[model samples]
Target chain A: MTEIDWKLSQDIQLLRLVTVGSVDDGKSTLIGRLLVDTKGAFEDQLLSVRRKRGPAKESEIDLAMLTDGLAAEREQGITIDVAYRYFATPKRKFIMADCPGHEQYTRNMVTGASTANAAIILVDARNGVMPQTKRHSHILSLLQIPHLIVAINKMDLVDYSEEVFKGIRDELGAFCAKQGVHDLITIPISALKGDMVTVRGDNMNWYDGPTLLEVLESLEVTDHIDEKPFRFPVQLVNRPQTPDLPDYRGYMGQIVSGTIRPGEEVIALPSMQRSTVREIVTYDGNLEEAFAPQSITLTLNDEIDISRGDMIVKPDQMPKKEREFSANVCWIGDEPLSVRKKYWIKQTSNLGKVMVSGIEFKTDIHTLDRVSTSELAMNEIGRVSFKLQKPMFFDSYAENRATGSFILIDTFSYNTVGAGMIV
Target chain B: MSKRKLTQLQALEAESIHIIREVVGTFRNPVMLYSIGKDSSVMLHLARKAFYPAPLPFPLLHVDTGYKFPEMYEFRDWFAKEIGAELIVHRNEKAIAQGMNPQEYGVARCCGALKTQALLDALEEGGYDAAFGGARRDEERSRAKERVFSIRDEFGQWDPKNQRPELWNIYNGQIHEGESVRVFPLSNWTEMDIWLYIRQENIPIVPLYYAKERWVIERGSMLIPFYEGMEDQLREGEKPTKVMCRFRTLGCIPCTGAVRSSATTLDEIVAEAAAARRSERETRLIDHGSNTMEDKKKEGYF
Candidate 1:
């Protein structure tokens, strides 16, 4: 064992990556190889994996069993849902979501890609760019994942041929270009053979780019969250009616985007009341200024009927406050979406009844074509318009992910039936 | 815009606070599960921070199996008072009265009746619509696949195959009556993150986490501490030996194992944790059989 370097460990940045491909494209295996090659898997965890599904040789282990944690998944010999796995090198800590690639599980892919800084869409070298690969890439682009990594897997099966790699790269690259993928890095590797993943094997000498892990470690996360306009959705109001602090009325929320400082004039939505930020409070004393992704309490200069489900933002940067809105929704409920049904929509600490006023069209997962459809079944993506019971404030999902996305809950079952992104 | 950015730890802290507040805002009633462990300590800290000036809006629930270490109980009470939050300690009195000991009925039966069933009973008693736990994805294999806001059916059973698709930071807290959701604010936090956060926040934890001279007897590579009334459970020729040990995870007194360590401070513990070869739950003895945690979770074990 080596001595642990606390400085490096504590200061390492976090990179969230998602793996997406067809069912046999080996997303789980790629993730498993990453964990094993990086020495992130624990001895006991590996031991259990080997005991259940490994080969007779101690050195050789079944990688897929490490994930596919559910019994049904193992029984079926495929991943059905998204599994989050963590690994790290000296420079960065990585959180990878191994998403299922079956066409019916598009919801899982979207869920996994929702928070990813980068997405690795595997392309089987033997098959080239399949429809599922394009579908995953399209969804990743739709979700605005900054980085796109095209891992042309199974190079060893193709005898590490450059022609095979180039063919798939150009095809997939052209398709991704259509999707507006700005940061695209395509690599050739064999996840099963452990080539060009963490280490560049001798077979891939023709490829000069960095390894997959290297790209993941070095890719700068282009997050402009703090630079965006300040939007705070009050989740709770803090008031200690105790004798010690009688006049304290603080608005608690996480700054979804941009920065905030004391004395900054802001307007509260729904109520349209304006006030200045008196103080930015946190557990570790008062911060001089707070930025996006920081959960803090704010004391206003004047308390003018502010409560939960209210948005506070700078007057100059106002969000669209309306009762009618349109969004792209991925229907995930077991029951098909009906236009007559009224669903409960929860977005940014606000919940209200919403009716599906119209269904513009549904995106065909296989061809990426928009077809007119009146109803959306399980795992179908569609452009839908809604009429809310009350006016709510929101931005387009592309502008601010935190304030722009909402989940539709079933009225009777209360299950999260659909996920919508404000258009 | 100022060039200020949140560090990884700070980002994780902010994410957890946001999750805690979401539960409080969405659910009619919510409670935090306090297990008197390091993760629970960090979770309680985040909860307090979520609503700083107003104190905690929810109470803390501890599902006691009556097999916890005395030090854990003391620290649990002390910390509950320190935070000025309501602490609800519930135990399966029927199972205890039935003399359901780990040695007699086996680890699975004992834990099922005591810990698992007690948690369900406690949730029903409080009528809590949502319960917050400190379960992290990095702890176990099955846990890695669980959602941040995991829903349980009317029978308090988890259907891993049929889970809601969680997207973005927006969690769906909607649940029918008799059905509840388990919110793990620390879902993304790993074991290393937990220890590091403990050190960064200077969160006080049970002293048993620190190494000290204690009487212990080895059982299949595990250092079983010598708690009161353990003499009868010891084998015929086995004798307790004094060794410097500390617990990596805290649970029932009879099941939780102690590791040989000299770490007594947060810094040393963090360093030790970083260099640990095996997983954290390896010290938990009751985690026997394959996918035991998954089985227990399906049966409503938090």
Candidate 2:
């Protein structure tokens, strides 16, 4: 317990990953194995797992039990919701979301993948490229995850044959290619036997690719969000109005996209009142330039009308300011979508009443088909048109994930019922 | 322009600061749940940074169990004054008058009355619509599935099955009149991140986190701190002895346990923490087995 190098561990970068596959495809087991080998799983936790279900051998304990945390999930032996797990090595730190693989939990998987930089799609080697595998890949592609790792799990069931692994890999590889997945890595792994996960065991000597952990650690997490157009969604306007600083009116929020500096010409949305950035302020000090994800305050040269739930952006590259738009939505509420119902659309710093104008088509994820459907039921993905009460500043989700994505809140329940991405 | 990528610690810090500001911007009345632990210390530091040059918009609420370590009380008072923050301390006097002790009523009943019930009563009295806690998702199994802005019902109960979908960084903070939101700014932070951040920011925490020679008694696998005048609580054939130990987590006195260690400095402690194999909660008496935390959370335990 005393061999840890603090200096080396502290210098690691952060990576966010989501694991997706079919039910009983060993998604939970792969994650559990990674956590255990990295020393993320404590001895007492492993002991408790063993105590719950006595293991025939020390290595055969049910690793999935470590993450299927809910009472119902434990009773049913299935992951009902997404569980976020953290593990770190000297090279990097990871914030991985263990997503449910059941087809009914597709909405949950989408929720988990919304913020993921990369995704690990688990493919059962015994059953190569199942319908669920294709469905998961389609979702990941639609979400625009930068990197993907297709771990061919249960290699031992196929006798760790290189031909079996290659055949499955090529089948899934071609499928991902059609989906325009640029960065994909395929590895043969036995999640149950702890082979080709964190370590390169002799059983996988035929496989020369990096282990699953290595791909996760070595993958570049460059999203280039700052390179996109500047889009700042003002969360709050700071007017502390102290005695010393009587007239300090600064707009405070996290920069969702692009970089901004003092003396930059910008305009607040809806009002369209133009002004110049006087100062970019933060707790540290005034910055020459501030980029995406950095929460800071800004003081403009002109005292225009601006408040919460408003967007600030450059004058040249304005987002689409319209009340009507088309989007792809994943409906998750128990109650299906009703055109008559009025829902609150919460986009980047903007909230307004929205109504379903029309339903274009619902996706058949298994075959990647768009079938015309009027009703958007639970766990269904569909293209829909919405008419908002007021104009909202946004970009295509493909262009700016921070500004293009939104959620639908049920008016009465106040629960987030649907996730939407602008077309 | 080519931008510099933030290290893991910096990224986590920014995310937490953003969350802290969301509470101030969204809720009318909010209070920070200060437990005086390492995580709480990190949270307090972030709150100050979130609204720098301006004092914290919300006050800190500390629910005292009346059985916390003496060092925790002193640190709590001193740290609050140091930050120039308004600290509200509340204790369940009725539960104390009824002679509610862990030894007498067991860990479950005592924690329910002292910790869970006291927290609910304090929030009600404060009328706080949003309460910021320092719970992390990586600490337990059930917590891993919890959202950043977890909504609690009128009675402060958490509905695990029907949690709202927290997408990206945008949080839906809308709630009913009686409902409240329990926000965890450090939901993504792990134990390692806490120590790394403490070292980076040079935040001050309780001295009990460092190794020290103190009177202790061996209780099962945990080392229970044996203070003077508590001899009656000792079991048969048990005697207090001086030992070098430090607490991995702080909680109520009778239930919390200390670990044997000699890592006094922050750097040494970080190394020891990285090397430790057992979970930190294993030392606490309240966390007996799985599902205990989930059940207690349903009844409003911080």
Candidate 3:
């Protein structure tokens, strides 16, 4: 078989979204508004759902039921996990992950927002910006979500005052700027009364920003950073020395960064095997080139012993494959992550059994303080050091997130114990 | 300067690959949960491509929700042969004989008892550390909130409130003794995208999804196929509808509903599916309860 390359596209086309803020910040309500206002929900489906829905306190439509579709979820009257919503505006489609505000489900928010591009941090106009607002915004920035929208909800509760909206928006603006947020858009709306949802509101004539749905539609979502270097994480080796194509020996992987063209000079990681790209094959058809996040199988002109767990990149520029590194981690398990424990580390396709060699420090997410610790307990976000058995090809998490991040798997019963972003 | 654009399939493929790598690296013996639904069919296709030329190192696990359509079994048997992957089927014959159905114990209880509970038992019995599923985030609220590497306790219960932090694209599959991870490779693929993919790839699916002539009894706005013994339980008051019906989704013979349609080809199905803004889960009355999936997940449901 000829070497085939699967290039999904040159640009990342999907948008990962999330709604943040503290309890009763109307995170759920805002999501409901976005989905409903966007006309993303079918009329028949909506009607049926409404009819079957349990009676709310005042016979009002339980908008939260739109996202909190689970039984235990509606019973609690609070979002407990990440409820993902798929909607589309005329501009682009989006996957909006609705995260809970309770401190207990902070980890869920982190998970949901990690892959998000834009976060709609709901701020109650009555309460202004609270600690949870700061905490969530910081987490979004840390996760490298490109855009932030501080939604001042419950405008009606505050009598739709331009002063209330301005105050909340300005406070958020200052804080986010200090936290390094560049694209913070402040919007005013009422989730209960459906003001400025699908339609702009006459009540808030002073506020002239795009509607929440419009923001989602018009958000600038081109890939962050430069696609200067081509980096592919080797997933599998395709060697079909069969009757069809005996000489076929190819390395398959998804390009984590940059672009790769056929006949381009490339180097395989660790071994640093230099070769020219022989071919790029894809399912739709063959392409002359490919880019980050696209899955492809590539053939080299030379017969190099390339295998899965190895990274392929341009010979001139390659990633730093290191044995030891520090990372900010969100502890997931009930038991604390002790230094003595051996955890399974997966970076791209490479596998390395690792141990927490040292406890560098932990981040008090709310305060941004680094605390020295040898262990991280459940629901705690911290920093730690890991010693690996084998060197892993990685970039700084901030530089190339897809290649630089990894998860620590508990070897024993096999549950994802922790997720780490390489520093 | 500009945010990268992510395609529907591209995002799904990346997420799936990430999950696959996590399973291979973390678990001792991982298996793919195959229900032979369009989702599972798409999942298996993804798994094959994920570790291509390696003959997919993991086996396939099918928890027999005994009420599955016959065509599903036909596809399952054929797919196993075509792909040459190991397949394991888990059936709770006791529940079948006792007739522990959705009508009796309620949809949640029935699914929880037969499908969810059966899955947990089978995993423990097989000593499989992880079971890769085709759950999409858009399927349900509980599932949307799930991590790619979802963890289950010794009893195999899912706690959405206290899930691990999943950062970057990295998925941590870690657990204590007896605990396992329910890995979802298609968490990002939407229903429309899956249909688009199936049409693009020409992935053969069960005929149930297409418009065809079949004997069906209408039960609660759903056309439950006339399976043996199931027909007798058909509500005496209602008459069966024999329209050229196609299923928007395939669930157990009981709860899954069929929409009246004459679209027989994949293109026609795509057109029909595109028009559908409602989720397939909505078609299944058994899961309509608010937080039902979450509750069942808490009770160790897949």
Q: What is the C-alpha local distance difference test score of each model?
A: 0.88, 0.87, 0.76
The DockQ values of the predictions, listed in order, are: 0.72, 0.68, 0.34
**What 10-residue stretch in candidate 2 chain A is worst by lDDT?**
A1-10
Tens digits of lDDT, candidate 1, B197-226: 888888999999999999998887999999
lDDT of 3 at B152: 81
What's the C-alpha lDDT at position A370 in model 2? Answer: 85
**Weakest 10 consecutive residues, lDDT, candidate 3 chain B?**
B1-10
Model 1, residue pairs in steric clash: none
Which of the two, 1 or 3, has more lDDT? 1
The candidates score, on chain A by TM-score, as follows 0.95, 0.94, 0.90
lDDT per residue (tens digit) for residues A1-423 in model 3: 111111111232567788999989887877777777766565554664567665434336667778886656778788887888887554556888888888777777877887887888998889987877877887777677878887889999988999888888787887777757767888898987788777887788888778877777777776643365777877667665657667667677777788888888988878877889988865455667676777777888997767767888887787787788888777776678988688888777776798888878876665667888768887677778888888888888888777877877777645567778888
DockQ of 3: 0.34
What TM-score is obtained for chain B in each of the predicted models? Answer: 0.98, 0.98, 0.92
For residues A46-83, could you state the per-residue lDDT of candidate 2 as single tens digits? Answer: 88778878655677678998898788888999887899
